[model samples]
Target: MKLNLFFQLSAWCICLCFSPVLAQQNYRNNEDINKALRNLVNNHKSHASLKSLTKTLGGKDVWVLTLSNGKPEAHPAIVIAGGVSGNHLLGIELSVKMAERILTNYKSVLNQTTFYIFPNLSPDATAQYFGKLKYERVANAKKTDDDRDGSINEDGFEDLNNDKLITLIRVEDPTGDYMPLEEDPRIMVKANPQKGEKGTHKIFSEGIDNDKDGVFNEDGIGGVAFNKNLTYNYPYFKSGAGEHAVSELENRALLDFLYERWNIHSILTFGPSNNLSVPLKYNSDRANKRIITSILKKDEKLNKHISEIYNKITKTKDAPKSVTAGGGFFEWSYFHFGRHAMSTPAWWFPKFEGDSLVKAPKNRKANFLKWAEQEGIENTFVEWTSIKHPDFPNKKVEVGGIVPFIMDNPPYSKVDSIAIKHSEFIIEIAKIQPDLKLINLKTEDLGSNLTRITVDLYNKGLLPTHTEMGAKSKWLRKINVSLKLGKGQEVLSGKKRLVLGIIEEDSSKQLSWLIKGRGKLQIEATTPHAGKQSITINL
Candidate 1:
């Protein structure tokens, strides 16, 4: 009996020793993500399928997972994207987890709506999260001269302290523009000369002048940031914006796929910019411009409504403040692609107080430090230690700051709950997708072979058939109402085919056709996004 107990103890120890190497609930690398996606597809083969939309220059596949119960082409769709900015690892995890949850528990939603989930658009850059030397990188694998110095990737980051991770490097100089924050000395704030404050220090990324170009890490490894390479509000000639909009293989492939998918009426992207917590304010001037750059008035209201729903579901308050920067996919989806677009980080650092219950710092980094300290999260911040630098020989140089990607992502254990809530929100949105139906059909015979047919095409769903921008762009297919008449039949008043534009929520379009026809006639109404309906009547 004693020998048996000893053997069991040894077996338990072996299992514990090998457990760390096994996959856990955490941010996944590219290989792990691929394996998980394949497993998910294989497990739910009937409703889910996986495929590569395109391949990056570095040979990483841009994978997409499609889910639907019925024919996806026959229903409205939502496009869920992650890794729009490569460093946002939480985006990728949230996207994957939401897909899994939807496939497992919320399979019923697939009956009405289709979902296209791009798990990671920037796979090459996201892979840096699992590299031997980890750092937050935004651009993809392609190499380019970002500094326009004619040398490609010549001035990349260097581990000045040899810590295997890139942090911030601070130099104490009299003519610098930064000063230590009063609340936390570990954090820095820009000097306010108007407030009688003087500049005393300069902050730079953790690196040295590799090219001796007077700048530190200006031309970094990688090129063409996925978020910045989009067409809408494309930053002309800007670094990481690429030579032109949609210039990269990934961008072109995604746009090409989107161009063909007329049923995609909504887009949900997990990225740096978020409108879920706080909806964007409507700008009438921007909306009325010939180019129409802003979110319209009514759509802003919808965004607010959805924001309330998101808050109610996630129970998130005091969300981190974020502004949607120009040249992002989030804006492009609404302004150009003409879909209801929603973007969120899905998780961020909750406000934290110390063991002494001190007030949270106002600065984001300082608040994060306090939170990390209270939670006892190790390796989140690097202590500022003085180091000799090649460029700043006489200045005091210290390499240290909050670790990259820590503030944007939460612990893996907390991600499952977040994913569940987002999945619920997505399902709710799907339930509200535009449902077109034929209502109040009437047919009256005036005389021999003479009939007047009238019908109202109603949008029974909460959202409009097409977005305001969509109606303006005319990119989405118009609502087509056709009357199939019998042989030797003709229409005297209205044309045989009717082309109508956007139909708002709970609204209907009254269509009348005075036709000189006999026998049974069929009237059909259809839009690529809103689905189809048909009715038959006799003359």
Candidate 2:
């Protein structure tokens, strides 16, 4: 009996050691996510607070978690957003997990930097992953007519093979625009007319043309995509981009919350777009244009520096290039919102390195399949099965393709480590936020009870107090330096209060003032985003 009890106690200790890993064995649904968020606030009430910015059309709460030791607006802030794309479930997981890890281990950093985490921004569409008929959905549940055919969701996807999964359907035809790649026949690629490639197969989303408009699944369920519903470079009249920019309730809610928070200096998003692994290049013409499309030269330099830090901390390499689509949240955050914005898909299929004799495939689909096979990931691809279709009755048609959401999100077992690396990266970034300091103080005793006071207002952190674009934007607050005089004191020379421009990292500006009379004078430098500093001197 004594031996059995000892063994039981040992087993309990082992379980405790691996509890965190075991708990995250699967992705959380909306209910689970809400409960987990509530529990986090309950457990870490001192440093973490949870609030719902608004409810989506699907009746899901768009939650934002604010993490700080003191008043959140009093310190420099970074906004970490996730689920910018509904198909990327890993993003939602990363945002929530990063918050939990930060509050648990890196709680000390909260004293200097505040974090506003918007996890699962596309909750309405992300919920479709857990729904029965799963596909790579991007839009919310606002009921849109995507194709503008005067019909609402009439040509949505159908489970042609009764598989309960929305895969692809291919039909053999002479005039087809798509053809199977020679390297991997399982994958399809657009036929290149310039390369003398002949088309043999036509592909469409697994569905029939219910509207009889010759388009299959053109208008699906759901409405605006949050990533494509922002104000910058909006894709007008585009599917999933909404009727206009900031049209959705979730979009308006997020922007309203962001506009109210003057302390947010930078924005980081976990989604399909990536600018962290490889920084964006600066184009002189684009930067000089009236609208300013490209990243400013100084800001581009900062992006490159931060990219190096991200690659070093995450050790991520050979990331696939992702283009910033019009109206993307990633671009809007920087171009229009005027903050230091950075985004990453957070995960991707690592580059396939074959032996000397075996050359890797060039096509993305072929490469992903090769990696998936090596990793022993199963059920990722559905085998092609012949099915009789109503649309193409004469031609031979089949349904099969890579499963939805798997390519963008890794298996659940790998998420914890991914979350840890991202959490570390975020903490490192917070440590380097622009910190204002008053240094190099000097005082001279002038004749006739007059005194000369000199000090250098310095930005000691690694990042500039304002991003180059932010400096030009009227939305951001300027750095204000003020001299508060004691009783019977008057300024004789320099202005009592002065507004300053951008302060580059590790740079300082000297300010000298002549006072007619002084007892105890206080000098204070304040900025909503860079933080505040003050000092007192006696004469």
Candidate 3:
């Protein structure tokens, strides 16, 4: 009877643990994220722990959730990061949901692998979505002079239509570079002079020119974007790249933590820069450079392989528009930090399917507008309404456009499916990580208390022991093999310690140590990313 009661209580506890998910609707706020993380950690205390990396300028904590079965530092680790770009709300949700899924469903995998998840990095800017006025914000709460006018946040967005939304404001001007698309007048496209098209409107963020600099919303609220503030090829003096690379407290904290954790072999970042749906190409010219600005040839092949796995696992066919990574975390993880880094936004707007005779609009906004309308998604676009602008006096100006964050993120109801697929893909990647083994052990007895120990060290998994970039970097630790001698044992020949470079998948190396030992000898092979294995031989 007591056992039955215990089983009933366990079922009740499981139901209570997931009750918060049923109540979830919109994207979580900072408070909700904190609560969710706390609940997940408490529920999975045996394998998970939560800690704050640092606090942002807005006093929001940048939290790190770690999951492992044993000492996490000893196992190969994958860093799953999100909210590198604040406006990409889906990234944070994916990160948090993936963590929860892993803990709840794939907890057994933690025995060989460790995961570090930073669910929300730009908490200050992300909080703006739940604020009184909503707009797409990409930076943290630190004040910035984006226009370099010697004033911080002097000019920002305004809800000109009094709708509490910061959309777009377009002014009718013949000399403008923007023109309405032929298919959808609600969307604007750049005029093509070669096509005999001329611009009829000037587009700006919904705001009056508060600084009177003839520019609208140039210097907006918040500061450097975390996604833009990284070390690899830092965009110096460029807007949103921060005063310098690794400047923010959040970036510094993450880097400081990552540098010490040598077991981190791969990074999966949820952000604007994606290489999973579309793999990065190998540029031979750049790859041959002394500075090595391109992905190494072998690494590019691995990327393609991983992309195939990602597409197959997710079954997603839509290809997102390609984006460059300049001073971005994903690029830094590979080029500077020397780890296999993969990034994805997890979801994007599927291609609109209309009559082929309709001739699709070249403008992205128009394409989305038409698609949203066909799907009966209401309130996605604000109808253009005329408004008198303070900057462009006597000019025809209007406030209207697509609502912020709607285009990038799907509805909350669709998140569970996307998260499940992504979690499956991540698990596939973890399963393929390098597994080192010691095989074919033999000991040959010789006279005069001498013995020979022979063993083959092999990488039995599909992935290499270390990434190509990791092998190139002196910072990454190499695979180490050492022999521990019994009492009164000395090395007669062979290396007592051997440091080997990148061990390709299914590759093996045979080593025999001639030792002057009395009874038994031990050999151990270890790598930060591949874990460690040992064997003992009696002579």
The numbered model that scores best in lDDT is: 2
Considering every candidate listed, which one attains the maximal TM-score? 2
TM-score of 3: 0.94
**lDDT per model, in order?**
0.87, 0.91, 0.88
- lDDT by residue (tens digit), candidate 3, 301-416: 88999999999998887767756658888889999998989998888877677786665565677777767777778789889999987788889999998998999888888899
Better of 1 and 3 by lDDT: 3
In Å, residue 182's CA in model 3 sits off its true spot by 0.8
RMSD of each: 2.4, 2.9, 5.2
Over the full model, what C-alpha lDDT does candidate 2 score relative to the true structure?
Answer: 0.91
Q: Which digits, one per residue and each the tens of the lDDT, describe model 1 over residues 453-478?
A: 78889999888998777787887788
How well does model 1 score by local distance difference test? 0.87
Cα-based TM-score, every candidate: 0.94, 0.96, 0.94
- Candidate with more favorable, higher TM-score: 1 or 2: 2
